[model samples]
Target: MPKQDNLSGYNNTGSDTSVFFLSGIPGLEAMHLWISIPFSSVFTVALLGNCTLLYVIKTEPALHKPMYYFLTMLAVINLVLSATTVPKSLSIFWFNFREISFTACLVQMFFLHTFSSMESCVLVAMAFDRYVAICNPLRYVTILTNSVIAKIGLAALARAVLLTAPVLFLLRRLPFCQSHVIAHCYCEHMAVVKLACASTSLNNIYGIFITLFIGGLDLTLISLSYVRILRTVFSLASKEEQLKAFSTCFSHFCAILMTYTPMVLTTIIHRFGHQVAPHVHILMANFYFLLPPMMNPIVYGVKTKEIRDRVLLLSHGKNF
Candidate 1:
């Protein structure tokens, strides 16, 4: 049980309590229960869906290609990202934020940014795979060998860790103000930073720079890769070949859009629409977290014939 529930009202300060006791925000209990249902539902679906994707790729020899390797990495990252937030979010909602320690929040934020950035890197890797397959088909095997793919995955992981380490390091220096209430459902970068009593100018600047570094850089690289892919597709002699090449990349494009669009929209809403409504923010938050993972498996299932068939084969007792 949360110590916050024992409190009579929001502003009550009589009782000395643990620093980590998640309390303060109004109507948290009701909000937590309300959000947990959908959060759990979507989290379960994402976990199972991504796990099935990993299994299909791993078990099916035919699916063991560079594209699927990167896809599996993406699935693993999403699975980890969902785990980092959903349980804590549920705890925050159901029992109040009393159980979450400052160290835990720092840890959670670190993992969240790490996984999210890694997903971006994986998307770029997938784009490179597509570029190679379409633009230099003859060299696909030479360029994207097992060793090369392993290097790419390792590089992505290292970059994610290095890029997000600052978040924890920088956050540790700030002192919390009196208001401990985070407006949103989770301990997001902005949400936690907002509680700082000290100067956050450097944090905000670093936050924006990091956002641009990860998001903008990856998007630019992916776009350039696709541009080359488009040229290669157009050069194909047959319409069927062009369509097939485009179809191969359609799901990836969809996944990219799903992942980044909400972020852009959320920024828009936060900057221009703060006073709009609370439910709107909640809806956007849920969509930001849920839509990409839920849609990723479906996109792959519908677009990639080999993955789709393998998933079906695994569903039944058929050999892949």
Candidate 2:
């Protein structure tokens, strides 16, 4: 019943019985390399994609609109998120489940959550930007000016910092047992907290609160913005204008689905289907954290004409 073998296929009784955690799964070293390959690959793509986005926004005067400003914020958040996890995850893969100190794990969890929450907030801002452009076209510039966009940026960063900073303090109060290994590829809050031997009611409660505030709040705002936008679009006198308005929001809508769907799926699986295969958790975790950023540039470029032209022009080294 050694602690290292906790949660493996061992005795499931007695105080000394190991819990056989997911870290004890055999051949994870090999699996780690497989996992790391995709992680590194996507990280590279995200870096290039988001950097291109930032560059296009910075250089192009025409791209200096509210929509592109919010897109820039999303790109920045994506860069941070990919940088936060992918390098550490790659290192862990090469090292074969290396032990992370409790403090470091907590720090990773905090960064991951903070960047994710910030991305969600930025997406909500993007939705609002689109709403203004489509529904309030005449005043879109006045309403979503540089000053207002700056304020929105500050608000998103503030929400993420305020929400995630407290998590570090909360984690500092929790004591880890001998079984300190985490289950997933990264130091996720819930997965790491599962290793705590101390009373975790407070941590769980606070985690739920943060999740709701970040995830639920952002999703609800985006939904409400779209509802108003749809109403206005339908009220347009010209069918062409209605189609154009809806088409303009398509990229943002795709981004929302890519970001939120995996999260909602993970929440449901972790709550109601914990008994599912470990591989399921691993797959969902990767998708939840990785896919959105990886697909963002494609979503925006393919669905939005301006982005597509910029990307094509950049590819050709043209001044566009």
lDDT of 2 by residue, 151-172 (tens): 9899878888898887878777
Error of 2 at 274 (Å): 1.9
Specify the highest-TM-score model's number.
Answer: 1
Candidate 1, pairs of clashing residues: 21-98, 22-97, 22-98, 32-93
- What does each candidate score in C-alpha RMSD? 2.8, 4.3
Task: Write down the lDDT that model 2 would get.
Answer: 0.75
lDDT of 2 at 101: 56
- Prediction 1 TM-score vs. true: 0.90
Query: Residue 302: error of model 1 in Å?
Result: 2.3
Error of 2 at 202 (Å): 0.7
Question: Cα lDDT of model 1 overall?
Answer: 0.78
Which tens-of-lDDT digit does each residue in 1-320 have in candidate 1? 43455444422322422243344233445455776788888888898899988888888888898899999998888888778877766766666655455777788788888888889999999999999999998999999999999999999989999988888889888877455555555567777787777899888888888878988899999999998999889999999999999988998999999989987777667656867665566567557678888789888988888888887877787883
What TM-score would each prediction reach against the true structure?
0.90, 0.88
